[model samples]
Target chain A: GGIITQTPKFLIGQEGQKLTLKCQQNFNHDTMYWYRQDSGKGLRLIYYSITENDLQKGDLSEGYDASREKKSSFSLTVTSAQKNEMAVFLCASSIRLGGHAETLYFGSGTRLTVL
Target chain B: GDSVTQKEGLVTLTEGLPVMLNCTYQTIYSNAFLFWYVHYLNESPRLLLKSSTDNKRTEHQGFHATLHKSSSSFHLQKSSAQLSDSALYYCALSHTGYQNFYFGKGTSLTVIP
Candidate 1:
């Protein structure tokens, strides 16, 4: 079994600061995704990439940018941190089967706290 | 637009009791895939159950869910609750050839001994 690794288990940033989160997967999956987890809000998709160098926005992509640098890595950047904004960012990868995505394998997540 | 709904924000039950989590969805596509994911503290959220065929029941890890197209629901259930069952549960939906997924607000279940 492969694993998805996310760097920086915790992050603390100041208002208006830019922060980036990185993810790497060994599953060799074709698609990668970034999701934001908030209390009582579940997980909201921020961005997803079907292939390397491809990016697609999701329902909650206003303040985030994503990059799929390679087949095994996906990254997300917070344009400007908001004060007291605290959330967990998750990275996931999945393979496409029969024209649709299969089960997603996720990272442990990066907890972000904006001060 | 596709969307998923999980009504209960929190559920507290005694061990050995039954487990039931409600999940409903709305989508324009007739062929939809419904999924149940469990998220334990400090761990990644993982797929607990998934179903695409209408009226079919899927089971995994002692958890089961049936996809009822007529009712637009896929509810997760178990015969007995355990302490390890306590976690956050999310219901998700996706359509054919769609890479984007819609997830519910989530329900947190706590099984007390």
Candidate 2:
């Protein structure tokens, strides 16, 4: 009965500005992830953390950075927003149970638009 | 590198018809897991079905999918499509003992009344 909360559900940013999206999960899960969703492209992993203070670069992490300072929170920052960039960023977390396949619980998402 | 592929970008169907979304994957690991996730508008994307055992059909909320290791496919299907079933679907792959997962481009299903 836990929830994932993402702040600033809709975001508008200026080109070249740094934008940060925040996610907090009360699931107490050990693994957290950030994903970007485009119109046609499925969700692409931006970054992931196995535990607090850990970070793993995903396939599309070139222009993004993530922080996992606490187990309950994970934040993603766009290094420099691009003009006309628009995408929905999702945050998810999972519980690691030995060798079992973990199910991901996701936050609603942060929709970003850069002018 | 591990990856998932969902060929159909969008599917339109009348209610009461059958529904099928094709999913295929490529990975070096043998014990990889395949999943079907549904995303309804204004809701968080959630897991619909998952399978790791080859040829074992996994069903949830009237949807079913079987992971066929031989074919490298895990397609989602439903016998009766409903208007409320309209949503975006995604196929994902994850390796055993690891949390890193890869997702395919989503398939948007529109079931009209």
Candidate 3:
């Protein structure tokens, strides 16, 4: 069994400040994803990478940027923090089998609070 | 476009009672996968069950769900509710070979003793 680790369990940033969240996985999966979790909104995909150096935007990718520099790591950056905003960012990795993705394994998540 | 819908935002039930969480979906593709994920406090969300075959039921951790393609529904159910079952539940949908997966708004269930 492998694990997905996300750095910085909690983050506090000032309005308009730029913040980055990091994720690392030991599963050797081919795909990684970044999702934003909001109460009552569930998990909304921000970005996903099918392979190293590949990036795909999702429905809620307007203010976020993602990078997959290595097969085991994926990072997400918030361009500008919104005032009084609070949300949890999750990192996940999955392996594709038979032309479809299998179950996703997620990290504990990074809680962000913008002041 | 693919989408999932979980109607109840919150459900409170007494312990030992039956548990039912509604999930519905929409996708243009005929072959779609539906999943139920449970998120406990301070823990990452994990898959509870998933199904792709129509009219077939999948079970895990005492929870079960049946995928009904005719109705576009995959509802989670359990015979008895426990306090440990209290958590946020999400319904998700994915099509064959599609990298993008759609998730519902989620439902929070609280089983009180």
What TM-score does the predicted chain A of each candidate obtain versus native chain A?
Answer: 0.98, 0.97, 0.99
Per-model DockQ against the true two-chain complex: 0.82, 0.73, 0.80
Q: Each model's TM-score, in the order given?
A: 0.98, 0.97, 0.98
Candidate 3 colliding pairs:
none
lDDT of 1: 0.94
lDDT tens per residue, model 3, A71-103? 999999999999999999999999997788778
Candidate number with greatest DockQ: 1
Model 1 CAPRI rating: high
Pairs clashing within candidate 2 = none
lDDT of 2 by residue, A22-115 (tens): 9999999999999999979999999999999999999899999999999999999999999999999999999987664499999999999999
Candidate 1's displacement at residue A31, Å, is 0.8
Q: What residue runs in model 3 are displaced by over 4 Å at the alpha carbon? A: none
RMSD of each: 0.8, 1.1, 0.7
Candidate 3, B1-113: lDDT as tens digits: 67899999999999999999999999889999898989999999998998899998899999999999999999999999999999999999987889767999999999999
Docking class of 2: medium
